[model samples]
Target: MPAGSPKVPVKFDKVQKYFGPVKVLEQFDLDVAPGEFLVLLGASGSGKTTALRILSGLETATAGRVVIGERDVTNILPKYRDVSMVFQSYALYPHKTVAENIGFPLKVRRVAKAEMDSAIRDAASQVQLGDLLDRYPRELSGGQRQRVALARAIIRRPSVFLMDEPLSNLDAKLRGYMRAELKHMQQALGITTIYVTHDQIEAMTLAHRVAILDRGVLQQLATPAEIYNDPANLFVAQFIGSPPMNIVRGGLEGRYFLTNGARIDSPVGGHVDKAILGVRPEDCAVVAPENVALKGVIYTTELIGDHTLVTVEIGHDKLTVKASKDIHGNQGDTVGVALRREHLYVFDAASGQRIR
Candidate 1:
């Protein structure tokens, strides 16, 4: 099939899955638009992989429905799902050459040799693996082998693509490169894709919309910016960022949030006995003692190229601040941390839900 072919949307309606008494997925519902890239992101055992497996027919849904475009595929077998899956392991046949591997799907469907060869060449060309077509999988580098797997998956021109952490095996640099390659290829193909990964970076970079799962429940589904800037709850606020959001336990008294003998101004009105205050590293700054939101001692400093990560010790907890590279600090140095009032997030301490 050619790139930019007409694609189909994928849907999961009240999908439930279980293994004995363990419920892996509970009342899951999601809709993936045609040609849109949707990422299922979560930590281990969060049901992201289970959700992908159900959609690909690798695992059956205990109840509810799975739909592909206009067809209900809730009970369909893997072979009939009309979707291509790329696994983390790169599932390439060691004995097969790159060309043979890419053409295997076509061969299985009994496509003509001429048409199969044409499709294989096209797929390999898209992934820049045409030059290594005659080479066997054992001889290729990890990235190249992954390209072969991707080429094979795309060769069939399926209506949808289901990828489960397909870039996890690669090193950091290679993974970054492959991420760009995958994103470009997916856009060029215009196929509805559902990607599963625990990597927040991957989910942020690849998805049109991200579905964040925690335990067996869907926490939030939104654009990366929305997920980062406006998290639905404490779990999402803490999980989506690099250093993660710094959450401090405190009590709300009127417009003041009190913690560790420090009182910080909050826009959230009213009072609460217990509350959770969240602020991203970039949104907090190191300021002079008198004009600060909270006062603490420097705990650690990491110079990460463009910026320096400064962690300040506050009582038993630490809050990280993304400071300028030129900023200098040492352990145990008395410092003041200032939070951007407009960027501060508040959540319910007990329920972990965002407090608007």
Candidate 2:
């Protein structure tokens, strides 16, 4: 760990939030290890931002407790909690120079000028903004402005770092670069960080562990590989993948899945009137139409650099098969989809739970 202040664990016990009659978070429970990067991931209105606000003391939880390093901070003032937040909007003074913006935190605390200047230089160096200190916010680029905001946040090195989609405003290429910068800074600072983002790529690449939420409820919390390979339910299965996992409605018969007029073998055995079969694009292949259990007309073929995604229309559903880069196919070509049984995921249609 990088040399810094002592790191402390954070906990949420039965946290609940409500705006009038609308429930945003219901008995939210999570534990973030000391000096760990945890990402809260979900779609819009999924209660991710609500939870972060609650932790930051900006929005109080309707019930439960928020603990930081064994201190009950649920009712503490936001400033008193010793946490710094980085907002999606670059919250910087337009007239303030980079050094002034970074040193503003210390200025508020009335630190000595010499100590404050030293801290500002240290923080700016961490974010690679040492050369831009004399420039005003308007003189900097989007990424530079973001780095200034980050420097302001880390200038204090509080117990925990709260970042709410800090990179969302940047373009794709810049976002990628900033993600690397954020990860490196966090590791070097050894600060406990809670980052919130709806972008799966960000969560997957940056978080030590991702906590996926939906409608104020945490669906699953696990490493990226575990969450991808063994999703807790249908929501996570569909949400995490880039192109999303393909779902086929079918009936389960013993160890087989029956869709349309075809019967396909599954790894898990179960009998149900309704079932959903999920297979990722990378786990499926396009084959000759006559020999497979599922055959359909190719709806479209998308060449995505490294591979070709062939979407086959099987009755009412379409399955995207990840084929080689050189694979050739037309829009209306007849093709068969071969799903690897070991990689298939079966979900109970009524409950949305995975069938192990």
Give candidate 1 regions above 4 Å deviation: 1-5
Worst 10 residues of 2 by lDDT: 1-10
Q: For model 1, how does the per-residue alpha-carbon lDDT over 263-308 read when each residue is reduced to its tens digit?
A: 9888686678889899999999998767775899999999999999
Sum up the clashes in candidate 1. Answer: 0
> Please, what are the lDDT tens digits per residue for candidate 2 over residues 78-185?
999989999999899998999999999889899889888889999999899999999999999999999999999998879999999999999999999999999998
Query: What is each predicted model's overall lDDT from 0 to 1?
Result: 0.91, 0.93
Candidates in order, TM-scores: namely 0.98, 0.98
Question: What local lDDT does model 1 show for residue 134?
Answer: 96
Segments of candidate 2 deviating more than 4 angstroms: 1-3
Judged by lDDT, which candidate is best? Answer: 2
